[model samples]
Target: MAGDASNRDLPPVDVAVIGSGIAGLFLALRCFRAGLSVAIITKKSLSTSSTNWAQGGIAGVLDVDNQAALEAHVQDTIASGGGLCDEQVVRSVVYEAASRIKDLVDQGVQFDLSAEGIYDLTREGGHSEHRILHSRDRTGAEIERALTEGAADEYESGLRIFEDWMVLDLVRRDLQRPEKGVAGLWCLAPDGKVYTLASRCVVLASGGAGMLHLATTNPPVSTGDGVAMAHRVGADISDMEFIQFHPTALAIDSQHPFLITEAMRGHGAILLTRSEYKEWKHTDGFPSDFSYMNRYSTKGSLDTRDVVARATDTELKKSGDSHVLLVTEHLDVQEIREEFPTIANKLAEYGIDLG
Candidate 1:
């Protein structure tokens, strides 16, 4: 691991990670445990990545009767992927999902649990079973805290985190063709000093370009720097068309869209058109009416994210509205308040409580 090497000797690290999100940090931790020196470079603090903003939980099967669940998970993923998913890759990740979750727990992540002393799994779009493991509403934040704490102990020892450092480009042996392999990176420090760190391997897990869209749930740092750099270095990039957008982002006029986690729907919230909601409230003063998703799929509100997002867009176009409403009136108020305190409180700012 090497950082703050402006005056000191720079050492070559075994691995160089160019992001501090869950993927990058988790990979760094694994490499460190295997006795590999690691360097993590991020333009901002470790907690500033999109990982800290994730609200929905990780999807996986933790119960013993996981064979069918795993199969369903894989199938659901493939279906949602619109037949473009690589079956081998899908199966590999699906099978390893539980073990990865266990690794997270081993690293100090505490997922939500039921009163029966079992992991309280919840459902989301594209999930057949309640296999999502979350820590209340702040699942991402909790995991980020745990991973940051774990990485801190290894920092400057087995791992070095370079915060406020921007990666300019990958240092490749042959700029003409990146097939030669990446040696390291050219980085710009906060003090306007440029430096380079050599490494045996470099990983670009720098996340997505959600900020490219006008309304996105992504943080400002998700400006597709990794993709751009990789493309510049002649790396093969794929699936630029498959950007996943959540269906229920909190749309306040002209404000950055805050994600309304799909887990809320998994917990029983139903999506409704503005007029449908208004009419329903006028009729009964409550949101017990059926949802538009019921007309599209048997899963209703539990349909896949792609389906829901498209449906919302269609409804918006049809009705000429800005956004849709997610009705949680059918769910228990106390349970919602307890399970999604962050969302509940945030909605309260806009004069919306679960009750």
Candidate 2:
């Protein structure tokens, strides 16, 4: 990073990437390896993005030889999209999953493996088969670590990383047609002075505007700065209406929303009502309970995230409760503790048992 605006001599670059999340860092790495002069501008340190807080895994069917699995993955995605998905795009991503997973692995992201020396895949909310590659529950953290280290190693090789800088707006070469016309960015340094850094191309990976919501699992940095800059420069922004909410979040003591991974439900955790929870919570071990999710969807808690979140919200509204109950007491406590040690320990801080 350069000095404050007064002392800085900003240089031109082939590409400028905003944000330090997985998308920005990965793209920056690829461009740097291609011998392009790359500069990454982030408002915070690389370790402070929403990606670091992501506990779920990346979905990829690595076994490319399995035609059935590949086709199933595509169908599952399209189905999850509820007839709104572009079939071509869904199939393209599904078919390319193996290659992308290989790319992540090449970047040194090590997923969990079983004793049989195979990748330990887990199934989440919507998927029919187990395809999620994770490092325990903190898959995103591991991926971010790999890319951050990769970027850090090449920082002195003309890979400029300007941290603690907020981009005010994107500069455009042409106002009439803004497609690929982004010239550079006007950014604010920590000292509150604005500076312009020119670039032939700029990539805005500044993540979503989830912080706009009254309650969200997004980190403080997710204020949609990149999107706002693009929109201000006459870029077309789509899917602003689709903000996904997690089905289970801990709102203890009115603190910021903390996500409880939905993988627990896929592992056979149940969502119970308050009364039902009071009745069966002390059982120590029970195979089944009344299917509360069945009232909303036939797939029950294993339904898609949007479906489950909506169901949970509706239940909260109807019951006039602050939250719906998600219990793992019936599941294997040892397996739960091992699989989700981070979540387990965090909950234990509040004197809550994950099991």
Candidate 3:
């Protein structure tokens, strides 16, 4: 099922894209639009990717009316990136966030919006303001749906999509004349066959290496394959220690760490020590029982992800507990249901009533 088309007299493709996640699909679509012959190779079905499991909305600068909000978000991101982020890249990504979001909308991606015609942006940890555009807690799924549809259209237009093909190794040939550079890859197909794929350009957008950690929010397939492959190919890797940890993954029976969006905290959910809540309830008067996150940061619960996660870890360690309570007393249960219907329903499976 996998072989160098050159061996079989098939037409050569202009580009070969590995992986069918958001990055790969979007790039393939762009290349197809540019009139280049393209092919996407995936190890499993195209739908199996880390992007599909994301519950948090993509962060973007959508509202010009909230310039401060935008600036704060940029600052928070930079801080969390821990000096590893290229300033230019960060700025470019931040500034272009709105435009990229618009591009997705133009491509038929529907994000949730408010009654006021504004994009319903939510705040996550490390964000200064509510700027995450979501679709009822399934933002990734919605975006993936749109991207996959667009990719299918490209496939119909003659772009090749080889599904269920596992890539083994890149087949690079040394130049005899010393002028021609490296060759291409030897990919493995599902049927236990190997094929050589020679291309002038090969793009690897395979995603992160969350599999090294015993406890990670990444999908099973997120085994740092791209990073490992790049390392084997002699690409200089940096900041291997820096990893982003979301604080509110559901602790009950989650096969993978099911992330609870920080938007819940942004909307006034409080992370509490069970002892604090219990002690306050048992006392004569409820003495301001709430432990607001300002004790951790000026931004309170809206502090950057690192801050929130560190605080959570420290609090849990001090309390000798595995999990802390997320109190949503200030938020209306009906509004929570309306805004996060999927999460509301998912929590019901564990007998945790969001109502």
Per-model TM values vs. the true structure: 0.94, 0.95, 0.89
- lDDT for 201 in candidate 3 is 69
Q: Candidate 1, 308: how far from true, in Å?
A: 0.8
Looking at model 3, report the run of 10 residues with the lowest lDDT sum.
Answer: 1-10
Regions of candidate 1 where Cα sits further than 4 Å from its true position: 7-9, 282-289
Report how far off residue 127 is in candidate 2 (Å): 0.5
319-355, model 3: which lDDT tens digit per residue?
Answer: 7887877766546889988877777888888888774
User: What is the C-alpha RMSD, rounded to one decimal, of candidate 2?
Assistant: 2.0
lDDT of each prediction vs. the true structure? 0.85, 0.85, 0.74
The TM-score measured for candidate 2 stands at 0.95
Number of clashes in every candidate structure? 0, 0, 5
Show the lowest summed lDDT stretch of 10 residues, model 1.
1-10
Cα lDDT of model 2 by residue, 72-145, tens digit: 99999999999999999999999998998899899999999998999998888889998888898788899899
The local lDDT score (0 to 100) that residue 274 gets in candidate 3 is: 84
Order the candidates by TM-score, highest first — what do you get? 2, 1, 3
Better of 1 and 3 by lDDT: 1
